[model samples]
Target chain A: MTGTITEAAGAADASAPRVREMSMQQAVNAALRTVLREDPRTLVFGEDVGALGGVFRVTDGLQEEFGAERVFDTPLAESAIIGMAVGLAMNGWRPIPELQFDGFAYPAVDQIVNQLARMNYRSRGAVPMPVTLRLPSFGGIQAPEHHGESLEALFAHVPGLKVCAPCDPQDAYRLLLQSVRCDDPVVYMEPKARYWDRRPVELAHDPGDMPVGRSRVLRRGRHATLVAWGAMVHRCLQAAEYAAEDGVELEVVDLRWLKPIDAEGLAASAARTRRAVVVHEAPLTAGLGAEVSALVTERAFGALAAPVERVAGFDVPYPAGPLEPQYLPTIDRILSAVQRTLEYKRP
Target chain B: MTDTTERTFALPDLGEGLVEATVLEWLAAPGDRIGRNAPLVELETTKSAVEIPSPYAGTVVRLHAEEGEVVQVGSALVTFAVEGPAGEADDGAAGQAGIVGRVPQDGEAPRRRVRLRPPEE
Candidate 1:
């Protein structure tokens, strides 16, 4: 009954807004439909986005609804996709281009990091790149090489681009809408694993509910805080719930925005809990986990009770197929990290 | 796993002590009712194109390797939901029955023929 399409008690009433149980895919599809319907200048284009829908069928019926000119496809070229978005953005068209997959964005790094990301500053505020590049990112689906790489650190390190990944269907809908509306070039990373994740989404279309660069606390606890983003957020929440059964209170913080991370939000929770553990799918070295741990340590050092722990992927290449379960941080790994932070002592 | 009998057939020796073969095409797909000795997949090893025969009569459950993948000798090629006894997997002693021709995948051409298993007794 969770993922099945269910109607609320009030049948066909016009009094209240509809609350539908939708998968992240349907929620995002609805968001795109709303954006395309509302804005005339907005154009959605990318590889296989036309008749093929998408590799994941995320853009299932856009071209039929919006016509060929507005929702179209490009040749299988990632660089050209970003280049055309910047050109259209300069010409007063709001462009929302899908990079197809996370690893595919590597082919367009120059267009992303150097040109599209920095064009506004180089042109001295004359050009605002209102381009939202949707990249289906992260692992857990055991995709082949170059299909499931976690490249958030690469994009978040860049100064000009704003990076954000949403965990649930609600965030997936709202953050996508917010990313499309923001003037700054945003790399909207949708966790590929959570695409089919079902949740009751309030279809109010409030993109302004939570702005980009803000983090939200999904669960509250006074012990250690499990900080994570994207697909790993759900895993951390599971660990928190499991920890609660053992009389251990673990706070779960969804660090939604990778870039411009909410330092105050992290410090506020970490200060109260006195311990923190960062989890991510990317490898540990120079990863966003390190950044989160550093930020928490820097801001909450005085209030901290123990050292911060980071449970992340091994410092090796992201493995494919059968090796992935061992590579990814499991719920037990997160619980162990929380236990270590809880049991730490001064030597 | 319990309800259906399945066999994960591995790539057999095409001929002459070959180690690997590139899958050129799949002649059978999942849900297709396959008969024993039917053309299962086309392969190229050492510059020869060859087709491997199915070992059991069953519904194709899954294809372990995709086309163009260089599957190693004795690696999983296909899994079939067959009708058979609850018997233990045969050991590798009778793995190489006879090399009729050579089969290759990934790095070269494919040719020749080698039965995956003796006809079900």
Candidate 2:
């Protein structure tokens, strides 16, 4: 019976790896453990990281294995946490500080944009700030005030900071490891809504060698290019599936990096499709979607069949739990944007 | 005239208008003597867990809430026995120092008491 069940499951999910299925949160935990084991100079600290193992338990069991010095907790002050990280990175330690939540990171903006980002340049390459700021962001879970937010564009706007948001368990595991090892300070945003989504990931390969600013094409198509990252990537994939029923083939690109965006990969994809649509969970006004759309227009304008489109959240603050659905971009909204781009005609 | 010996240490508003907190653990027992600013109990709120220090330096006569109990703001957490007036000594200490999680600056005014409802007109 066991053999038959295994065979049936294998047939059902051929892409599934032979290894165990892991959630995004579990993948992050595994990645942190791996990095801490490999790098002696690396230290992980943030609020509730020690005995409590973090509020979300992402740092769970890390303190027990790595000891208190390596994995410890700090006072509930975001600015002080980031300032100390800058100091530690300057002194030769690779400090990884967890910001607990997205909205809470506002207090540390001075330290992050001013000190962390400008250190290497201000010192004329004499100093390298290799700090990783882990932020849990985005909405879908009904959390109280300041819990769910997607403020990626804020850090992406900074010149020196490298911003990254991974959508899946595999990317979360790999991209996080890469971010930690990079010489520049990286803002690693984790979509909290997708934390429990499980997938089978190959653990044998090292993701440390993966290029940081490259985009991955999850699906190929000729009609339009759908660019997204973090939770919106999955949403775009679903929209593509929905659009396929009407014979619209949408190429989905997971923009793994936000800052130093994969402009070349995006242009190549847009050039082939001759049309583009950018999607994100942040507000529409000055979100990353605008940046991606502008990049495509500048680089791939000659190949465009229509003006680039964008589907994003409203400009207002992320609404309370009941109204979040309307605030976020749904599959219908993405499909409508894709439909509009497909119907555009030259005057 | 009232004979004032035991004082009730009402749990102060931890700011942000948070209503209640779960008692994670108690650092001092009913019969134990605790110093001012020493952690008396640990409480877990929605944002973070904080060690609440004793406002009065005296012997703890009784603990109002047990571990794992959700205590409301303004509820009596501990009763302490002290010499002289019941509230005079602790009032001065509370004004001078702040709680563990919510520390006040040297020249900053003491936090205003948090009230659940508007005052009567």
Best by TM-score: 1
Candidate 2 lDDT over B9-40, as tens digits, reads 87765533244779999999988988888988
Best candidate (score: DockQ) = 1
Give the alpha carbon lDDT tens digit for every residue of A192-274 in model 1.
Answer: 77776779987665656577789999999888888999988988877776676677777899998998899999999999989
Which docking class does model 1 fall in?
incorrect
Against the true structure, candidate 2 reaches a TM-score of 0.72
TM-score list, all predictions:
0.75, 0.72
lDDT scores for all predictions?
Answer: 0.80, 0.80
Q: What share of the true interface contacts does candidate 1 keep?
A: 0.00
Chain A TM per prediction: 0.94, 0.93
